[model samples]
Target: MRLRTGDGGETIDRQDIDVNQVRIGLDLSVPARLGGLELTPSGTVHVRRDGGAGQTGDGIEVAVGLRAVLGTARLDAQARTLAHHRAEKATASAAWR
Candidate 1:
C-alpha cells in the first residue's frame, strides 16, 4: 500500500484558463513468483479537487497494472481511466525491458 499528496496547475486550451488542484492517490500491489517468473499486480485510485479560473468540479482516476520478470527480461502493462467533470479519457500501455 502507498499514499501520496500533491498540488499542481494546468492551462486549458488556448484560452489561458488556469486550473489548480490538490491531488491524493492510493496504490496497492501484490507480488509473487510463478515457476521461473516473478509477477506483480497493482492498482491505484486518485482524486483531486479542481479550483481556479478553469475549475470544473472534481476529478478521479483509476488504474490497474501487471509486471512480470524472468531473468534479465521484464514486461509491464497498464490501463487507466480518468474523469473530470464533463471530460473523460482512457489509456493503455505496455512495455518490455
Candidate 2:
C-alpha cells in the first residue's frame, strides 16, 4: 500500500510517520521613507523537525525570506519562506491600508 502526507510527500509501508516539531521564528523589518519612496528590508528564520516512528528519520526545514514594501505594494524579490511551512502557501498579497 501507499500513503501520502500533508507535506505533498509520499510514504511507503505506511511509514508510521510521527512528526514533532518546535519552531522559533522572527521577522524584523525597518520601514522608513527615503526621499519619496517607502522601503522596508525584511527577513525571517525558521527551524523544525519531522520524524517518523522508530526514529527512522527526521525531515527538517530551515528557511529564510526577504522582502520589500514599496508604497501600497509588496514584492518578494527573493525566496519567500517566511511564516510556518505548512501544507500550503500564499503567493501574493496586498496592503489594504
Candidate 3:
C-alpha cells in the first residue's frame, strides 16, 4: 500500500509476502497523522494445493490491528494467525516537544 500526507509532510509505503510450502499471503498498510491519531490495517491470505487447476485448498487467515493517540503518546497493536499457528505483537511510544 502507498500513503501520502499534506504538503511539506511525508509519504510511506510497505509490502509483505509469505513464501511457504503450505500457504502464501501478502499484507500492506499506510497511515498519516496530523494533529491527533490515525489508524489503518489490511491483510490477505492464499493457500496452495498439491494438484489443482485453479485456486484450491482450505486457506484461512485473520489479522487484527489498532492505532490510538492521546496527548503526546501513541499506541499500535497488530495480530495475525494462519491455520493453527498464531502470533501477536504490540508497540507503544511517546513524543514531546
Candidates in order have lDDT scores of 0.74, 0.49, 0.50
Ranked by lDDT, the better of candidates 1 and 3 is 1
TM-score ranking, best first: 1, 2, 3
List residue ranges in candidate 1 displaced over 4 A: 1-17, 83-97
The per-prediction CA RMSD against the true structure, in angstroms, equals 12.4, 11.8, 18.0
TM-score winner among the candidates? 1
Model 3: residue 29 alpha-carbon error in angstroms: 1.1
Query: Residue-wise lDDT of candidate 2 within 1-97, one digit each (tens)?
Result: 6556777755486455565655555666677776756666665554544334533222223333445555677776544433333322223222222
Better of 2 and 3 by TM-score: 2
Taking the tens digit of each residue's C-alpha lDDT, what string does model 1 give over 1-97? 2334465555445565577877799999999999999999999988866677753456677789999999999999998876433323433333432
Q: Could you say which candidate leads in lDDT?
A: 1
Ranking by lDDT: 1, 3, 2
- TM-score for every candidate vs. truth? 0.63, 0.42, 0.34
**TM-score for candidate 3:** 0.34
Q: Count the backbone clashes (under 3 Å) in each candidate.
A: 0, 0, 0
